[model samples]
Structure formats: C-alpha cells, structure tokens
Target: MNIFLINPPNCGRSIPEERYGITSLKQIFRGEPLALEELAGNLLEHNVRILDLKADPDGLDRELREFPPDVVGITGVTCEANTVLQLAVKVKEACRAIVVIGGIHASNDPGFFNHAAVDYIVVGIGKKAFADLVCALESDTDASALPGVMRTRPGRALERPPLRNTVADLVVEHSPNYELVSRYRSHYILEKLGITMGFVASAFGCPHRCLFCSIQGQTGGGYLTKPIETVVRDIGLLVDIPVIRLVDANTFGDVKRATALGRALFESGLKRQYLADIRSDTVVRHPEMLRQWQEAGLRAVIIGFEEIDDASLLAMNKANKASMNAEAIAILNDLGITIVGDFIISPDYDEDDFDRLGTYLDTRRIDLPMITVMTPLPGTALYLQEHHRIINHNLDYYTLTNAVTTTKLAEERFYSRYAALLANSHQNARL
Candidate 1:
C-alpha cells in the first residue's frame, strides 16, 4: 500500500523556526523524527512507503498532489492538532485516501478523531496501533473493532478496547527495525557530533504523575523494562551509529535497569555517547547509576526543570521543587554530564520572577536552560483548567515558546527574556 507519513508543518514550532531555523531548542530541537522513522521501517513488511515530512522541504500542496498515498498518517501532538485537521481536510477533499492520526495527543485524547476528515485514529504504541489500523483500512473491515482505535460509522461512532498496553509481544520480527532509524542518520550525526544515533527504548512508563504531564497516566505508571541483554542487543544494532538514545518516558526510571543498561552499553563497545530525558528527582535518587551511565556513554541529559519557585512548582503539579532541579544540575554537572535543561516562563510569573529565573540559570551554572512560555497543550491538565485564559486558540501558538496565555510578563518582555536564554543555549552548545 502506498502510505504517506507526514510530520506536517509544525505550527507550534513555526515562530521559532522562522526566527532561528530550528524548532524547539537548538540543541535537542531535532524534533521527534526518530519515532516516525522507526515506524516506517516496522511498516515496510506491510510493503508501505513512508515519508518523513518534517525533514521534507517541499510545499504541502505540491507534495500531497504529487504523490497521493492510499493512507496519510499524521503523528498528532496537541500543538499540531489544528494543523493536522486542516491538512487532513485538504487531503481528503483533494484525493480518495484514508486519513489517520496517532501519537501521544490522540492516545491521551481520542476525541480528536471526531474530525470528519480523519478516517481512523490510532492510540497507544505506534507499532501495533498503526498496523491494526492499516489492516482494517486496507481490508475494508470494521476498523471500529481494532484495538487502540476510534472510528466513525454511518450513523454512530465506534470505540474499541485500547490495545492491552503491553510493551513486549509487539515486536513481530526478532529484530529492532532500523528502517526508521536509518532515515535521519544525517540529522543524528549533527546531534551526536557527526555520530549516528540509535533509538534505545528501555522502559515504557513513568511512575511520577506530574499534572502538567500525561506520560504517567498514559503509560499507566509502572516502568516496563526489557531484558538487560535485550537492551544490550538493541544498542548493538546501533553500534555503528555514533550515539544511542533511550526513548523512554524516563529511561532511568529504574536504577537497576539503568545500571544494567549502562553496563550493557559499555560491554557492547557502543557507549561513546548517549542521550535521554529523565526528571531531576529520578536522577537524584541514584547518583551512582548516572555515573555508570556516563561511563557507559551518556554524554548529556535533557531535564524538565519547569520552574524555580515553590508556588510555581505546586501550580504545575510538577511534584518536584525548584531545589531538586538545582541539586540535580549540581550533581550531574559535577559528574561531568552536560544537561540540556528546559523551563517554561508562564503568565504566572512577573518580570521579577523571570529575572530571578534568568539569574538562577546563570548562578546555577546551567549550561543551556531552554526557556519557553508555558504552553497549555489541548490534552494536558494545563489546557483543561486554563483554556479560558489562553490568549490564542490557534494551535500554532501552542508552540512551547509561544505565550498562548497572558503571562505575568507582557509579550515584549517575555520574548526579550526568551531571546537571552536562546543565546545561552547556543553558547552552551559551543561549550
């Protein structure tokens, strides 16, 4: 089947891309290409062609018109939902193709599938969720029966049992499909410093229930770990790649697993450089474990240091305090691990608060703390509670850096403060 997998024009990242030629943060803003690319390889057995639209330079209409696929699948994010809906509407109007949307956004909030243009909505892990959706679409079967899916029928809507959220048993082949891994080798090269980056998913769930985060709730809490050897063998697939990235909600969620994974990476002779995102509290829980990861090839960490003040911390449901972020930075930096820190400067903070954060970034010696306007995505608690306060409903404005809501600081000061942080991120990358 001819399949057109699109990353879509990142409406959320548009402002930043226009300003700096990069979306998200400069260092780790490579965007979420790895998941889609990997899914493509997993899908090749189905004889479907996959395209990474994020890396594509062609104009939207030009590409869609040129090569219409039997199905056009979009990985949905809250910030990108509006764009996805509009694009799906256009594609359906222009061609006879089924449209599907998946990813965390659809999984957390399947209601998005109500879009008439969307033929099927896949939830949960893409590997199984997508395959089932494709089979139903291709066979003209009752797609509503497919697990982890929601679809509309002639007069009623059909919602199916979410696929048993199992991380194991999904791998059809004994091999970890590198089909997706190979698509963006060049991009990983730059991120890993001319080294290829392999995706290594060690765990599936987060134990922490941060209100602002949907991960813990989505994965249903406990950390699901693969065999240490399986983890080792996965890295072996990317031994040729310069870097191995752990795509866990929190790879280091389990210290024993983290240590074993690190040990395996070291033993496999593939531990030159690795990267992953994990919370500061998790890191503090096991200092030696991180040291082992560093010894095993961990060069940097992408942490969620959301805010520095106690009230801000409590409001976000972050659970961890500002002090944890600071302590984590100190420990990790002392251990020689580079941290690509992330923080959201919301309407909740005044100019003084922002000034305090800026000073904290410098005083803490945070190499690159990527600061952003607190973005209330559609599915998150932030959006639900504060939807009325959101300044702009346009999905494009939800780009983490955009002030979708009136922040404590005005638009000008917020942007100016962000500009300073961006400079710091660039400087940190060089350092």
Candidate 2:
C-alpha cells in the first residue's frame, strides 16, 4: 500500500487557538509530527510507504500524481480543519486514492466523515486505526467495521469505536520513518529546529473535566500510561535526539513512574534533555523527585499555574492543589528545572495575580513563556458548559493559539490584550 500523511500549514502568529504564547520559545518546541510517522512505521510491515506533508507539502502534488497511492492519511487538529478542507480537495483532484483523516479534531467530531473528500475517517490513535485501515484496503474489506473509524457511505455515516484499547503501546518501537519525512523535509520543522523526532506522550486522557478541554470526550475520559522502564528505554533509544517531549495530558501524573523514569534515564547515561507537564500537587508530594528528574537532564516543566486568585481558581476548578502551584515552582527552580509555567490569563485575574505571578517567577527566575488566553475547546468541560455561548463554532480556530471565546470578559478586550501580549513579547524577544 502507498500512503501519505500531512501536518497542515500553521500560519497563525500564535500557537493554535492562542492557547499559550510559548510558540515564540523554540525551547518549548513545536509538537513533533510523530503520530503520522508512527502510523507510517506500523504500516511499513505491509510494504506501505508514508509521506510526511510537514517535510514537503509542495512536493506532495507531484508525488501523489506520480505514485497515485492506494491510500492517503492526513492528521490534523482544530487549527488544520480549514487547510484539511482544501488539502482534501487537492488530494482527490490529484489522484483517485482513498483518503483517511485522523486527529483530535476529527475524533471529537465524527462529522468530518461527511466531507466529500474523505473516504474514511480514523477518529482515534492513528497507528492502530491506520493499521486496520491498511489491512481493510489490502483485502478490500468494509473499512467501516474497523475500530475508531467512521466510513462514509452513499448517504450514511458508519461509526466505529475510536478509542484506543491499549493506548500505552501506540508509539512503541516507532521511528519517524525519516525516509518519508526526508521526501518532504523542505517543510519539516524538526530539521530546521535541530530537533530529532520522538514521542511527546507518556499518558493519555484528561480527568480534570475542565469546561474548555476536548481531550476527555475525544479519548473516552480515562487515563493511560506506559511503564517507567518503557519510558527510560524510549529515552535511551533517543539519546542522540536533542529532546523527548512528554506530550501527556498528564505527563507526570504518575509521580512514582516519572521519578523512576527520570532516575533510570539519568543513571543510564542518556544525555538527551527532556521536557514535560507537571501537575502542581503531584510534584509537590515529592520534592526530591524534581531533583531526580533534573539529574536526568530535565530542561523544563510546562506546568499549569492556570488561575491565581482563590475565586478564579475555584471557578476554573483549578484548585486541584490549592496553594501547591507556588510550592511546585519553588521546588522545581531549586532543582534547576526550567519552570515554563502555563496559565490561562482571564479578566477574573486582577493585578494581584500578575504581580504575584511575576514576582514569583522573577524571584525564582522561572521562564514564564506565556500567559495563554483560555478558550473553550470542544469536548473540554468548558466547551460542554459554555459552548452554547460560543460565537465561533469553527473547529479550525480551536488551535489554542487564538481566542475563540465569548467569555466573562468581552471578546474584543480579551483578544486585544492577548494580541498586545504577543506584540510586547515579540518586541522584547523577537522570537
């Protein structure tokens, strides 16, 4: 089977949906296109080839015209819906290949199957679903029967289970299929950023039930994680890679596992740096774990210090740790791990929040890469709650890099402040 996977164009000046301003910080790193690559690797057992559009979108048309693949896979998030819409048309126009679209955006909303360009939609983790789709295509089976998929028929949409039965093993033993990315490396960010490709996930599912998050609805509202040894092994395998971002919704949710992974990697002499999310309460439970992670060369922690004041924190349901946010930062700083605090700056936050937050970071010298403008995303608790009031229903704008909310604060005021924050940061850092 012949296959192609794409990372659609990211044209926003900010991170998708304006979630956070860390886009300017290369250190925070753009998410690697590992999902499609992993999906590609899984397909390789069947003599299928995967092409990365991220590495080469321009050459894609030429390649598609030449190879005329039996199947093409495109992965995307909310931000890429617009691009995917056009790209899908272009794919079909270029060739008669079957098209499969998968990602968070597609998974949460099964409506993508209705698109004329899509033959099948893989709604869950791409590797397992792609493997099934490839087999179905090879044998000419009814592809809709595959799990986590929904096939478009004459006038009907068939839904399959989109949940990964064993999410922990999705990226196991996977390589980026560099040959594929190389074909399109002209557009690939990894080569330019000097970052080697690696998995960004250690866990899946969100339990917080935040009103604005879509993760739970997409992944089935539970959690999954790999053993610490698996993580250590993965790290050891990527020692030559500059970094391995733990892309878990709760990267360090399992304190013992993360601690063990850190110590094991450090003692293993793997010099590669690591980055991940750290829950405020979780990390505070074991301060020594911070040092353990740092000793393992942890460079940064993308932590949720979301709301500052008591009322706002309570409203945000972010009182998970009460006052532990402050404690977590102090500990991580003492241990020499860069504190890349993640916050949802809202109108509810008064000057005290900024003053205290700024003073805390300054005193600790924590790298506050961004104070994100919180926007409710589909499937997130916020979306489930306030979605009725959302003026914008465009899933494509839900990239977290733009403000898509008609929130407690006026939309214009919220966005303008966010835009000004970006401008001010740009003036200072010019990232």
Candidate 3:
C-alpha cells in the first residue's frame, strides 16, 4: 500500500521559536515531522512519503493529486486541530484514499473530528497500532478490533482500548526514517547552534504532577525509557545531523537512567551535540551528571522555571521551590552550558507582575528566556479546575501566547507588555 503523512503548518501562537531572537519564528521552529518519519519507518513494507507543511505548505494539493497514496495520515497537536481537519477534507477531495488522523489533538478530542472524510483515529502510542491498522486496511478487514484505534462508520464510531506498553520497545529496533526528510534538512535547525538538527526521543512520559501539565493524562501517568544501547544506536543513526534534540518531556526524569545514557553517548564515538529538557530539582540533585553530558556534547538544557514566587510554585504542584530554579541556573551557568529558561505569565498578571518577571530574568542573565501566557490546556488539572473560566474554546488561541481566560490587565495592554519583554530579552541575551 502507498502511504503519505503530513505535518501541518504552524498555527495559534505568535511566540518566537527562540523567544529571545529577531529571526522569523517559523524559520526557527520548523522541525522535521518526526511523527511521520517514525510512521514511515513502521510501514517499511509499503511505499511511504512525508510532507512537512512547515517546509512546503502549497505542495499538499500537488502531492495529493500526483502521488494519490492508498492512505493519507495526518498528525497534529491541539492547536492544529482545524488545520488537520481541513487537510483531511482536501486529501479526500483530491484522492481515493483513506484519511487517518492521530496525535494528542485527535486522541484527546475524537468527537470533534466527526467529519465524513476522517476514516480513522489512533488515540495512544501509535507505532505498532498504526502498522496493524495499515495491514487491516490493506486486507480490507475490520479495524475496530485493533488497539489504540477508532474507526468511523455510518452513524457510529468504533473504539478500542489503548496499548498498555510504551513505544520504547519499538525504538530499540527502528529509528525514525530521517533519510526520508533529507530534502528539507536545512529547515530543521537549532536556533542557538545555528545548524541542522535531528530529534530523538530518549524516554516517554513524565512522573511529575505539575498542575498545568498534560503529559500524565496523555501517557497514563507512567514513565518509560529506551535502553541505553538503543538510545546510543539512534543517536549514531542521526550522525548526518550536527545537533540532536532529545524531544522527551523529561530526559532526566530518572537521574540514574539519564546518567547511564549520558555515559553511553560519551563512549559512543559520535561527534553530535544534544539539547534536552531537565527539571530544576534534577539539576540540583545531580549537577555532576549534567557535567558528564556537557563533556559528551550536551549543549544546553531547557528548564521550566514556571514561576518566581514560592506560593505560585506550590499552587502549580511543581514540587520545587524558586530557590531551586536559581540554583539550577547558577549551576548550568557555571558549567558553561547554555540555559533556555521557560516561564509562564499568568492571565492574572498585572503590570507589576510583568515588571517583576523582567527583573528576575535580567538579574539572572538567563541565556534565552521564553515566555508564555498561562493556558489551561484540556486534560490538565488546571483545565478541570478552571474550565468555567475559559472564555475561548478555540484551540488556536490555546498556543500559550494568547489568553483564553480573563486577565487583570486589558488584553491590548497585556500583549504590548509581553511583546516588550520579548524584545528586551533579545537585547539582553548573551551574544
């Protein structure tokens, strides 16, 4: 069977890719469609093609008309819901193909895509389930029985249970078909390093219970990891790319496991730098572990210093103090590793709060300070607690740059202040 997968164009947030830069946000944030790349790897028996709309948005109609695959699969986040649906409609109009949609958006809100063009939905970890679904489609068999899949039929939606295991098992045997996306290699770049990059998932899920986080809800609140050997092998396969970004929710969620992976990479004889996310407490507890990775080409660590106030930290159930964030920043600075600090700007923030945040980042001299307005994303504890307060239900506005709830400051004034902060941070960023 012929298969085609697409990564939809960026929508929702006007936030910059490296929130501290003047470059076009789209250029900085354009990533290779790793989801499509993995799906292509799983469907190795079939002819597969991928089109990342970020790289070429106008090519979709052309591909649908020219290639005319047997199956057209699309994956997107909550913000890309409308865009994916529209793409599905266009694919159905252009070709005699089945449209299957997956990813966090489709999984969380299956009912929203009650369109006739959407033939199927894969809800959870999609590696094996997707391959199985494809085989069933090829054989013209009943697909409702497949795990982690939902089939659309006349006046009915067929459902199945989610897979009990994680995709780490598959990562051991197969890496994303990075070669398929070789044409758009220059588009997938790391802003800090200013070079081409590849994404590798070292682990899955997060064990922490931050109130605003949706990872626990998505992954059944459990953490799973690939073997160190598997991770090293995946990194080696990505040798063509200079930088590798571990797109894990928490690469250091398990300190010991992370340390083992770092040791393996250091000894692997591969000359690739890496970037990953780390919790403040993890850095505080294991600075030396990061030091080892630094020697092994760990360029920077993205830390979510969510808030500056202890009370706010406790409210979010971040399980760490403001002091820990400061300490972690100091440690990374001392280690000579770049730090990408992410902070949430609550909708309730007044002019005073914005000023305070600016002062904090300036005082710390954070390398790249990324800011976002606090959004109550669906499936998160914060969403459940503040569902009634959500004035905007449009997924596009939930990009974290826009306020979906009421704000203390006027919307115009709030955005102006936010824009000012981004410009100021860029000017202050270390050259």
Candidate 4:
C-alpha cells in the first residue's frame, strides 16, 4: 500500500499581526516532520513517503498527483486543525485515498477531526497504533476496536478504546526514517545560529501537569523515556546534522535515566551538541546532572519560566517557583550552557504586569527569551477552567501568540505591548 504522510504548512493567524499590524509577534516555525518520520519508520513494510508542507507548501497537489497514495495521513497542532480538514478535502478531491488525521491536536481532541473528509483519527502516541491501523486497512478489517485508533463518526462523539500508553507505544526499535525528509534538510536549520539541527525524542509526556500544558495528552500523563542506546542511534542517524534538539517535554523528567543517558552520550564520543527541555526545579535539584550533560556537549536547555512571580506560577499549576527558575538560570549560565527561557504573558496583564515581566527578562541571563501570550489550548486543565472566557472560537486564532479571551487592557494595546515585548527580548537572542 502506498502511504503519504503530510506535515501542515506554517499556519495559524497572529492577532497582533492581523489586527494591530504588529508583525514582530508572528512566528514562523521550521523543523523536520519528526512525528511523520516516526510513523513512516514503523510502516517500513509498506511504501511510504513524507510531504513536509512546512518545507514545500506548494508541493502537496504535485505529490498527490505523482504518488497517488492509498492512505494519506495528516498531522498538525491545534492552530492547524482547520487547515488539516481543508487538506483532507483536497486529498479526497485529488484521489481515492483514505484520509487519516493524527498528531498533537487529534491526540488531544479526537472528536474535532470527525468530519466527512477524515476517515480515521489516531490518538495518543501513534507510532505503533498507526501501524496497526495500516495493517487493519490492508486486510479490510474493522479498525475501530484498535486502541488509540478511532473511526470518524461525524456529528457524534468519538468513542475510542482505552489506550494505556507504555514504552512499546514509542516503538523506538524502528528509529525515525530521517532520510524521508532529506530533500528538506536544508530547510530545517536553526535560524538563529544558521546551522542544521535534527530532532531526536529522548523522552515523552511530562510528569508534572502544568495546567496550560498539553503534553499530558501525548501519553495520558505518563513519563516515558527512550532507551539511551536508541537515543544515541537516532542522533547518529542524522549523520551530517551538527545540532540535535532532544524534542521532549522534559528531558530530565526521570533524573536517573537522564543521568545515565548523559553518561552514555559522553562515552559514545558522538561529538554533537544537544538542546533539550528541562524544568527549573530539575536543574535546581540536580545541578550535578546538568554539569555532566554539559560535558557531554549539551549546548543549550529550554526552560519554561512561564511567569516571574510565584502567584502566577501557582495559577498555572507550574510546580516550580520563580526563585527556582532564577537559580536554574544562574546554574546554566555558570556551566556555560545557553538558556532558552520560555515565558508566557497573560491577557490580564496591565501596564505594571508588562513592566515587571520586561524588567525580569532584561535582568535574566537567558540567551534566547521566547515569550508567548498565555493561551488556554484545548484539552488542557487551563482550557477547562477558562473555556467560558474564550471569545474567539476559531482554531485559526488559537496560536499561542493570540489571546482568545478578553484582555484587561484594550485589545490593540494588549497586542502592541506583546509585540514590543517580543521585539525587545529578541534583540540579544543568541540561540
């Protein structure tokens, strides 16, 4: 069977840009479709090809005409959910292939994709579940019984089998078929450093449930780590890529596993730099582990310093404190490891709030301060708590940079401040 996996294009409408003409706040993401690559790796028994719309947005129609796949799988985030449906329509019009939707959005809100254009939705970690789906499709058997696989029932609730995600769901043995995106390799560069970077999943599903976080939907609030050997092999498969971003919600969620993986990387003599996500508390508690990782060519760490105050931190249910975030910043700086700090701006921000956050970023040693508007994404605790306040129901404006709720300040003023903050913070971004 011919399988075609697609990564949605750089999408999502930016309120600041579209409304206030604040272009600085609009983000353009660039990366290999690692999720699609992972699913393709498991479907090696069948002919598979990847169409990275992020790299080649116009190539979709051409590819559909050329390959004419039997199964077309589309993956995207919440903001791209609407676009995924549009693409599904295009696929249906162009070919007789079955349309499947999966990825972060579908995994969290499976019912959203239960449209006539979509035939199935693979929830949770789809590496193994998607393979099982393919097999069922090939045999012309009922796939509705498969765990994490849902048959679309438009205008109705989607009832799926309970998926108890375990280590097997990762299917690390197959390794991501990185070669599938070889043609788009040059497009996957780290724009800040202008160097090629590859993604390798070291861990999945964060242990801590930050209210605003959607990672728990990936594995139903479980922390699973890929074997150290598997991680090493995946990095090795990238071959010529100089930097490897450990694309995990929290790379050090399991300190012991992270410590062992750090040691393994050191022993393997891979000589490649790595960037990974870590919690502030993890760094404060295990400074020694971070030091070990630094020695193993850990160049940078992305820390979620969501807020500058403990009260706001608690509001978001972020277990770590602002003090811990500051301490972690100091530790990483001392270790000569770059810090990519992630900060969230609330729509309730007044002049004083914006000033305080700006002051905090100005004083911090974060090499790259990534600031985003506080968004209550669907299928999150925050969303459940704040859904009533949502004014914009359109998924297109669900980009983290947009505030779907009413702002404490005037809407235009709110976006102006956001644009200013982003422009000021990125002035000295190093990585």
Q: Rate the local accuracy (lDDT) of all candidates.
A: 0.68, 0.64, 0.81, 0.92
At residue 146, give the lDDT of candidate 3.
77
lDDT of each residue in 1-431, candidate 1, tens digit only: 77777776535644435544444342224543544554565665454544545555355677666776788888756777777788788888888888888777777767766777888777666666677677777787776766666774424655555566676424534445555435545654444355455677767767776666766434544456667777676667765666666777788777777777777877877545787888898888888888888888788888989888888788887788877887898899899888878787776666777678767776776655667667767666776888888767776566566667775665555566667666765565521
Supply the global lDDT for candidate 1. 0.68
Q: Model 3, range 261-362, lDDT digits (tens) per residue?
A: 888889987978888999999999999999999988998889999999899999999999999999998899899998888899898999999999989877
**In candidate 1, how many Å is residue 289 off?**
0.7
Could you give the candidate ranking by lDDT, starting with the highest?
Answer: 4, 3, 1, 2
Q: Give TM per candidate.
A: 0.86, 0.83, 0.93, 0.99
- Give the better candidate number (3 or 4) by TM-score: 4
Over 4 Å off in model 2, which ranges? Answer: 12-31, 47-51, 54-57, 153-164, 167-179, 182-200, 236-239, 347-364, 407-413, 420-431
Q: Go through the candidates in order and give the clash count of each.
A: 5, 27, 0, 0
Sort the candidates on TM-score, descending order.
4, 3, 1, 2
**Which candidate's TM-score is highest?**
4
Steric clash pairs (candidate 4): none
Residue 428 error, candidate 4, Å: 1.5
Against the true structure, candidate 3 reaches a TM-score of 0.93
Per-residue lDDT of 30-107 in model 2, one digit per residue for the tens?
445766766776776654555545444476667676677878777777667767777888889888888888887777
**Candidate 2: worst 10 consecutive residues by lDDT?**
20-29
List model 4 lDDT by residue over 187-264, tens digit each: 999997899999999898988989999899899889999999999999989998899999999999999999999999
